[model samples]
Target: MTADDRIAITDLINLHGHLTDRGDFDGLAALFTPGVVYDVSALGGGELTGLEALRAAALALGEANPVAHHVTNIVLRETADGVVHALSKGLGIMADGSAGSVTYEDTLERTPAGWRITHRVVRPRRTPLRG
Candidate 1:
């Protein structure tokens, strides 16, 4: 991917976190394709397809209002299939006075609207086991 592609994809990832944490459901859904697959099963969240389903799932799974989400350390690569693959770290300041983190693995495609995420898998970043 070119430098512009990398920046665009990185911005898209960060925008998702901003919109979701700000409760801008429509804005968040607009960042993905119509049939985007959001797989959060690793966090006990099942796969949700389509914008409507994604919005509903987000509402259901989201913490109460006033949450903060931050995305960082984005790495983007263009796969042989012409898809942009992205990995980033997600940090959250939850409403319940707790903090958490996860790793986001994303597949993004260039769409008419812009570069949008087509599929994403959220996985827990495990700590190294004690020797």
Candidate 2:
């Protein structure tokens, strides 16, 4: 990935994390298109869309559990509509110390402001058992 693409993708993901940590529903909802798809099967299934619904779901989840999301290994590719596909690994931390990590498949769109995520998917996987 080009340096600029990497930077843009990183910024978007960082902003998402920040919004998530702060429980900034309004801001997070605004980041997506009218019909954004959020798929984190660990939480539920298939596809999810609409910023309002997304915000509500996120807030509800946040209220139930204090958590942190960390992402890495971001891969960026340009899409036909000028959107950017960003793939990465994500780790989720809970308040009580329990944690889970997974591979995050995300797609972001380029806008006047910059890159904004249009879709996000996470496949949950348990930590490898140590010998």
Candidate 3:
């Protein structure tokens, strides 16, 4: 992958966190593929497919709409199929003043709309990383 590719993937990862925290569910969905698979089972939800399912899942599970999402430690790898795999940590500041953390295992592809996530697995972090 080129340097530009890496930058683009990192930006996409950051955008996901920003859009989700802002409760812009539709905007978040726009960042992914049409048949994107989102595995949130680690967060008490199942694998969600497509934009509509993603939107519904977010709305249903995210009763606490206003969240602060801090994303860090992004690492990316490009595969033979031209898809990029990104791993990042997300730390959320809940509306109720509680904090939660998860690691995002993402597969991204270069789409007509730009780089989009094709799959994402959200794994709850037992112990968050700090620096």
Residue ranges of candidate 3 with Cα displaced over 4 Å: 127-131
Tell how far residue 107 is off in model 2, in angstroms. 1.4
| C-alpha TM-scores of all predictions | 0.89, 0.80, 0.88
In candidate 1, position 5 carries an lDDT of 81
Better of 2 and 3 by lDDT: 3
List the pairs of residues colliding in candidate 3.
none
Return the candidate ranking by lDDT, descending.
Answer: 3, 1, 2
Writing each residue's lDDT as its tens digit, candidate 3 over 1-131 gives: 89988888888888887787766777875689889999989877889899889778768776664378888999998889898889999888887998888889999999888899999999987864688
What range of 10 consecutive residues in model 3 has the weakest lDDT sum? 57-66
RMSD in order of candidates: 1.9, 2.8, 2.7
Q: Using alpha carbons, what is the TM-score of model 1? A: 0.89
Top model number, TM-score: 1
Best by lDDT: 3
lDDT tens per residue, model 1, 1-131: 78888778888898987888777878875689989899989977789898888778867765553388889999888879889888899887777788777899999999888899999998876675689
Ranking by TM-score: 1, 3, 2
Which residue pairs come into collision in candidate 2?
Answer: none
